[model samples]
Target: MKKNLWIGGEYQSASSYMELKNPFNLEILAHIGIANQGDVLSAIKAAEDAKDIMTEMPAFERAEILEKVAQYLKDDREECARLIALEAAKPLKAAKSEVDRTIMTYTFAAHEARRIHGETVPMDAAPGGQGRLAFTIREPIGVIAAITPFNFPMNLVAHKVGPAIAAGNSVVLKPASQTPLSAYKIADYFHAAGLPAGALNVITGSGSKIGDILMKDDRIKMITFTGSPEVGRYIRENSGLKRVTLELGSNSALIVDEGVQIANVIPRIVNGAFAYQGQVCISIQRIYVHEKVFEAFVEKFVSETHKLKAGNPLEEDIDISAMITRGDVQRTKDWVEEAIKNGAELKAGGHSEEGIFQPTVLVNVASSEKVSCEEVFAPVVHINSFRHFDDAINLVNDSKYGLQAGIFTNDIHKALQAAKKLHVGGVMINEIPTFRVDQMPYGGVKMSGMGREGIKYAVEEMTELKLISFKTE
Candidate 1:
């Protein structure tokens, strides 16, 4: 199948194309159009042209369009899930969950569209103020550039586009090249829902080729990106004065306190660490277990990891699949080897079979190891023992990336303490760091990125606040 760029409400061919292959079986999925400099500029221009239309669109109309798109996604949920599995190598069941989340995200955006209002200011609060009224309202921030990642392709794109549309902003989307099909599918839904021409455009290709153009263009008012810290930093440095919302990398950690039921939490931790082969930004990579329960937790974790089935993502029974690229697989392998060389004990899995890295667990790993300190976007986790609650908090906060961290504790005081001192965007008291709903204010501090997403917050990011006052004589 051939997939072309969706620009100006039409499918346009490009001069070059790249084959998208299924990572698990190496089957050719589709030939995706590679956007060049001209293509990127054209997409930005299209979005810029549609800005007025989008800005002038009524709140009710935007809500209705988002509702229609949500219904369409629900109707074709299975097909969309299959596309994600093929393109992103996400397991079938996990892909379906992502589709469900995408639907919820759009639904949330639809509801937020009507609620996009500002507050009334007390103009009479000042000493000289009298007989005056003042209020603030939000206006759309012209054209937006949404750059999405390969993991959770549809849902992540929905996180950006759904909210952009909610705020009445035209979007120029550059989906990750490996997973452009899901983005194209979303564009089709928006088009079918009667979005205006040029309101939303999808350009797919290498980031190096088109990313700089999106960042530097004055026509694009905001750039919402989800990927590595390196790219996010480059965008922040170069996107001069344009609104930027970045959801970057994370080395999320989880702390397991003493006296908790180890059996109840082991499964949750295992799933959090290995779901979708651990490509998720909030996937738990570090575990600081209470020294008393360390041995018991490690044993159960390894036993559960052994049961995970590694095979084709299309199969319903499969729990694991191939990494996105051979280079990523090799990098993960090298990291595991290096950790072992540094005196880390390989508890469960330290190797790959047929390109799928096993759900690996390591113990006695130093804080400086790559798998412990860095955002190892793989199914690898390091387990360490912490004697005190403060020590656990410090251990989780040791990383430069502070996206989210979790604490499994029954103690209210300890949970509250971790929540305040974790140095991350979110703290899950009893839940895993991977636990996120569609309606929460989600973003990170430090190297994790800036701004926030999740419908209402994202709408706030995509809009500019304007104040209006009327002085009555």
Candidate 2:
């Protein structure tokens, strides 16, 4: 397939193009037109031109457009899923799930479009303010620049673009070059749904070249990004006065307490650690099990993990597949090897074939080891024992990236206590850290990120509050 850049609701080609290859096998899936810095500037100009059109549109009209886009996606669900799997090498089942979530995200945005409410102020409470009437209103911040990551090309893009549109803001999107087909399809949906020209523009090319343009443009009022902490920091520092919402990386942890049933949660743990090749930001990387149930937990966890099938992502039963690139596999392998050299014992499956690394489990890993400390964006997990609940909380909070943590305990008091003391964005009681629905306020503390990402929360980030007051004589 040949994909063109979508700018101002029109598809166009450039002189240079890039080929997107399947990560599992070096097969060219599609050729996407590349946008230079000049093209990026054009996109920014288009979004700036659409500011009045977006702001003047009625909320019901905006909601209708978003609903139509959601219907378009549902009409072509299988095709979208196949494109995601072909470009990102995600398993077919997981790709389908992602498509479902993307549909829900747009639907939620549609609902939020009509629900932007403001509250009236009580001026009578203040002295000399008897006849004054005051209230606050939310308004769009104009042009938004959305930079999305490759791991979740469809849904993460939806998280940014959907909310921006719901908040009545025009957008210029920069999808990851490695996976631009999904973004292209979404742009087609927006156009087909009768969104006005220039309301949404999708640009594809080198992130550094186009990203710099997006950041430096004064017309852009906000920038929303999802990537590494290093890039997030750069955006924060350089985005001068523009509102920024960053969804950065994480090394998520999970705790298994003494009273938990080992058999009941083994499957959840296995899926949490290995799903989508463990490329997700909140994929389980560090696990702390209470000493009383440590042996039983490891035995069942490794047994279930080994049962997962590794094969072509197109297959229905394959649970493990290739990483985004061979470089990622190599980095993950190097970390695991370093941990082993430092006296960590490999429990099962620690090798690589082609671009796929086996779902690996390690024990006795030191807290300072690379595999334990760093964000290993591959299918590898480290399990350590903790004697008490306090010890488990300390172990989970020891890392710099406190995105989300999970604790399993039947006692309500223990679970509530852990929720209060975990030092992360979310503490899942009796659930895995990978648990996330599209409607919740999702973000992290410390190095994880700077803002939340649910549809309503994201709309808040994309807008600004204005106070309107009047004196009634």
Candidate 3:
């Protein structure tokens, strides 16, 4: 495959390159353009210029461009989904779903762009700070440096780019080293749909090198990142005086209440845990089940999990594929072993290495076990049983990562109670923690990260409100 850097509405190539592989079956897919400092600066400059024009562009025109981009994606659905699966190691169904979500998020952002109205502050009604007629109007921050993660490559890019574009900010996108092409595809669509030359740029390379340079660049006004907590912290510490939005790691939780039927819920939960080989940040890493239904749920859950066909992502009926690399398999194996040794019993599918890992489940897992406490991106599920609703809520709250949770109870009172007390970004009733709608506000609490990603809320978080007025003297 011919891969090149997309800078300023065009493709540029360098002699240096990075090799991209299909994690499933370990085949080389293509060589990607590896960007250096010079390329990064040029992309930043282009985006800065785009931001300057974007602010003055009619809001209706901006919204039309966003809508056109969404249409372009929908028109090219099959191509995009296939690329997502091959490059990002996502299963076909989930890969297609990512494309679906990207279309939805972009469309929502398009509609929102036109509605970026400022509310009139009745200065007369407010106390002294008035006469200013301080109506808050949303203004696009200058330029954004968006660094996305491997999992949900297309959707995560949409999460950042959609909001930035909606708020009229120019953006320079850096896809994960492992997953790059899909993002370039997004930039191509925006350009094809008649976006201004400097509106969006895509550059891909080593995170340790290009990531820091992008963050430290003075021209880049905002840095929006989605990755590990360690890297998130590094970006915040180094990106001096710039606005930052970090969607970091999550060892998300799912609570199975005593009321929701166990058999009815396990399939969706298993799909969430094993989908995309469990690479998603919002996947169910820890599951807390009420004591009344704990063992029953486990019985059905394990049986259903065995039926999950695990193999090449390109092949049909394969639920889980090989992880991103053989090293990923090795590390996951080691973590599983550590958890097993630390008194967590392996319930199902613990084999790993050779770039393939079986969907694993561990029960009677200690609260302190690494599998339970840490973010295991593998298809392993840690099950802990609680006798009461309050106890289960407490157990879920104990963890530091709180991206999302699922409460499977029919009782509205209990569900509402759990939702209020869950302390996470989202609460899903009658669903697994993997449930996410493109329009919903998606983010986490505590160490997981800052800010939200779903379209409307993200636009609010991505831009600044500057109230301007003309004196009617």
Candidate 4:
């Protein structure tokens, strides 16, 4: 199949193309057009030109367009899921879930579109002259650049694009090269929904080639990206004064306290650690179990991990699949080897079969090892024992990342304590760090990146606040 870049509301061919393959089987999926510097500039120009049309559009009209896109996606959900599975090698069930979430994201954006209002400020209360009225209104930030990742290509793109459009801002999307087809399809949906030409432009290709163009362009008012901390930092430093919302990497942790139901939490933990081969930014990479329940937790977690079916993602029963690239697979192997070499015990799944790494678990891993300290971004997790609940919280907080963490505890005080002391963006009691709904504010702190990404929060980021004051006679 041949795919062209979606720029200026049309399918335009580029001078070159890159082959997109199914990561699991190496099957060629499509020849995706590679956007060059000129292409990126054209996309930005298109977005800049359409800024006024989008900003001047009424709130209800924007909501209507978003609703139509949601309906269109719902109609073609199955094909969309298949595309995601083929491109990202995500399991069919997980891909379907992503599609559902994408729909929900757009639906939420539609709802938020109509309710994007600012509050009236009390001028008198601020020591202003008595007869003054003050209020604020939100306005689009104009030409936004959305750079999404390979994981959850559709939904992550929706998280950025849906809100940007809903807030009356034009978007220039740069989906991950590994998963650009889904973005193209979404652009098609927006087109069919009667979005104005040039309002949404998709440039597909190498990030190194086109990313700087988007970041440095003064016309683009905001840059919303979801990727690694390295790239996030690069964008932040080089983008000059542009508004940025980065959803970066994380080494999410979970704490399992004593006296909790071990069997009940094991499956959820397995799913959290290994789902999509642990590509999720919030995938649980570390587990600090209370010493009292360490052995039982590890045994049950490994048993559940062993039962996971790993193979072609297109198969409905498959639970895991290949990582996005061969380099990632090798990196995962290296990290696991390094951890084991440092005296960590690999309790289960230390090898790869058919290019797919097994769900790996390690115990006694030192906190300084790469697997434990860094964002593994693979299906490998380390288990450690902590004697006290405070120790577990300290261990979870010791990392440079502050994305999200979870604790399995029946004690309300302990849960609340974890919530207060985890030092992350969010804390989940009796739940995995992977727990996230479409409408909740989701982002990280510290190196995990800045800003929130729920539909409402994202709309707020995509817009600028303007204060208007009037003097009463």
Candidate 5:
């Protein structure tokens, strides 16, 4: 069945349509209505008109509706997972995990809705202000433009939209063109959960056209986006002072300290590097091993990467699946070839066919090579050796991105030092850089984008602080 645009709480068709397909199998899923500039205008207008209605609703009421939506998601978990797999080419196993996380995202949003508190300011402390009591109140930032990426379709969308609604703001969602079905499912869940009409609208079409409309529109007070750094920078510059939360790219690093337990680390390193085909922003792309443990770590890591089964996403045995498109697969292959040409040693699984790229492991990838420095949104990882702990930290910090980094060391002193010295947003002592929860403060430094993204943190970004004071005495 063809899918229509969810605008103003109604599903309607457009004159033109976009044919949605399964990139793994090339099967036609549906033709979503191609929203034009006019459609985008309508969505913005609808959200603007619905602002008072959303703002006037009590926080408890918003919490109830968000909780109901979370319940609805839990009820239709399998179907939602299937939709994510079909649309994004994520393996069903990983897709199910994403749906589970999406459920938790909304649940966290519900929890935060009731507890969105403000702070008391010391206005009277100033010499001029005597007997003036001042406090801060958080208010919704009006209509928000939520633009999500193709990877982690559901949860990323939830990270933006759930918090926007919880903060009492209407949203105009522009989901990735490849994975609009999941956004449609989100819209249905919200609408069925008794959300006010026009409070949440989903428009599916050309990202450039619709995004330009949203970026230029003054009605949208804020924009939350997750995508490439180039596009993120463009949005930031062009939005012209609009409040924006940008979650961009990363070539995340993981450091294997000397004498770490290899048996426990191998499986985690494999999963962190290749899970979701490394399309994740903070997916482990670079590994720096202490020279003493380099050879052993590489051997074990290769062994684990070999055990992964790649096939159709629906298969239970599959560990990795296809990229979003063949073009992406080819680009990954090209990067591998370029790295190999520049003195990198290919260790295991560098071949790709159809849309599935094998979990590739490389070593000796120079810092100047594309694979070592750039965000490889593919199932690829590079291993290099460092002489000292400071050397390892320096190598990891030598990139344009500082999203997240991990260190595997039992040394408490080393771990603590690295936590402070590393230039990323979050540091995991024993876990992988890919470790993330729906409730933790997540985002990065440098080119990895600005601001925080966990449900509570996102609520802060989606709202503005207003100073309320009263004069007495």
Candidate 6:
């Protein structure tokens, strides 16, 4: 199947190409046409001029268009899911779930559009301002550049695009080369929903090659990026005069306090650690369990992790999908090796036989290990024991990544204490570090990322606040 780039509401082809590999067997599914620098410029030019779609379109009309797009998403569920599994090599279930969430994101944005009204301030309430009237207004920034990641490719795009529409902004989308097709399907929804041409555009290519051009162009008013910290930095450094929001990678940790129910949490913890082959930014990369339950937790966690059936997500019963590429598998294996060399113990599934690395768990891993510090972006984790709740919290806070963390404890005080001290962007008490609400403020701290995603927070970041005050006459 040939995949086409969605440009200015039409399917277009690229001059260059990159192979989309099936992570399970290391075979090419299809070749994605990589966009050239020229294509990048075209997208930017279109976005710069398309501001009328956001600023001129009525709010209710904008909301209606997004609602139609959301309905179209439901109509094309199977097709979109196939594209996701083909590109990102995710399991069918997870891919379907992402599509489902994308649909909701669009619908939610439609509903949120009405909530964007500005408020009028009474001058009588202000000091020395009798007979004066003041007010605040929310308007769309002209052009939004959305840079999404490989994991949750569809849903992340929705998180950016949905908010852009709700806030009355024209958007230029740059989806990950590995998983760009899903975004095209989204563009199709816009087309089917009768959105005006050039309101939203999609360009698929090397982020490094096309990204600099987009960032440097003054047309791109706001950049919402979901990728690695290193690349996020490049965007921020090169983006001279544009507003930017980043959702970079993370090695988020999870703490299990003493007196927690070990059996009750073991299975959930294992799933969180290995879900999506651990490609998720907020997946549990580090686990700090109390010394009392450390040995038992390690054994149970490993045993349950082994229960996961790893294969193609397209398969009927596989528990985990393949890695995105052979290189990803190799890197994950290498990190495990380095962690072991740095005094971490591999309890299960540490070797890489093919593109599919086994679901791995490392115990007694030192703080010095890369598995504890870097974002592995694969199904490998470091599990260690903590002597005290404070120690566990401290260990979890030691990393530069602060995207998300969680604690499992029945005691309300312990949960609250950990929630207050975890030092991450989002903390989940009595759960693993993988929970997120679509409307909540979602971002990271330190190297994890800058700025928040989710629709409301992104809207705040994507817009320039302007307050108008009137002189008393």
TM-score of each: 0.99, 0.99, 0.96, 0.99, 0.99, 0.96
Residue-pair clashes per candidate: 0, 0, 0, 0, 0, 1
**Model 2, residue 284: C-alpha shift (Å):** 0.5
lDDT against the true structure, per candidate, is: 0.93, 0.91, 0.85, 0.93, 0.92, 0.83
Cα lDDT, model 6, residue 148: 90
Count: clashes, candidate 6 = 1
Clashes of 5: 0
lDDT of 3 at 62: 78
In angstroms, the error of model 2 at 194 is: 0.6
C-alpha lDDT of candidate 6 relative to the true structure: 0.83
* lDDT tens digits by residue: candidate 5, 45-138: 8899889999999999999999998898889988888888899989999999999999899999999999998888887788878888888889
lDDT of 6 by residue, 171-234 (tens): 8899987777778778888877877777788988888887888888887888889998999999
Residue-by-residue lDDT tens digits, candidate 1, 121-153: 998899767788989999999999999999989
Name the 10 consecutive residues with the lowest summed lDDT in model 2. Answer: 7-16
lDDT score at residue 398, model 5, on the 0-100 scale: 98
User: By the lDDT metric, which is better: model 1 or model 5?
Assistant: 1
lDDT tens per residue, model 2, 1-473: 77887888898787688888999898998888899877888889889898899999999999999999899889999989888888898999999999999999999999999999788999889898789999999999999999999998999999999999999999999999888889988999999888889999999998988888888999999999999999999999999999998888888999898889889998998899999999999999999999999988999999999899997888888888889999999898899999999899999878999899999999989989888888888999989999978888889999989888998888888898888999988889999999999989999988898889999999888889998889997
lDDT of 1 at 107: 96
Q: Between candidates 5 and 6, which one is better according to lDDT?
A: 5
What root-mean-square deviation over C-alphas does model 1 reach?
0.8
Q: Which ten residues in a row have the lowest lDDT in candidate 3?
A: 126-135
Provide the lDDT at 417 for model 5. 87
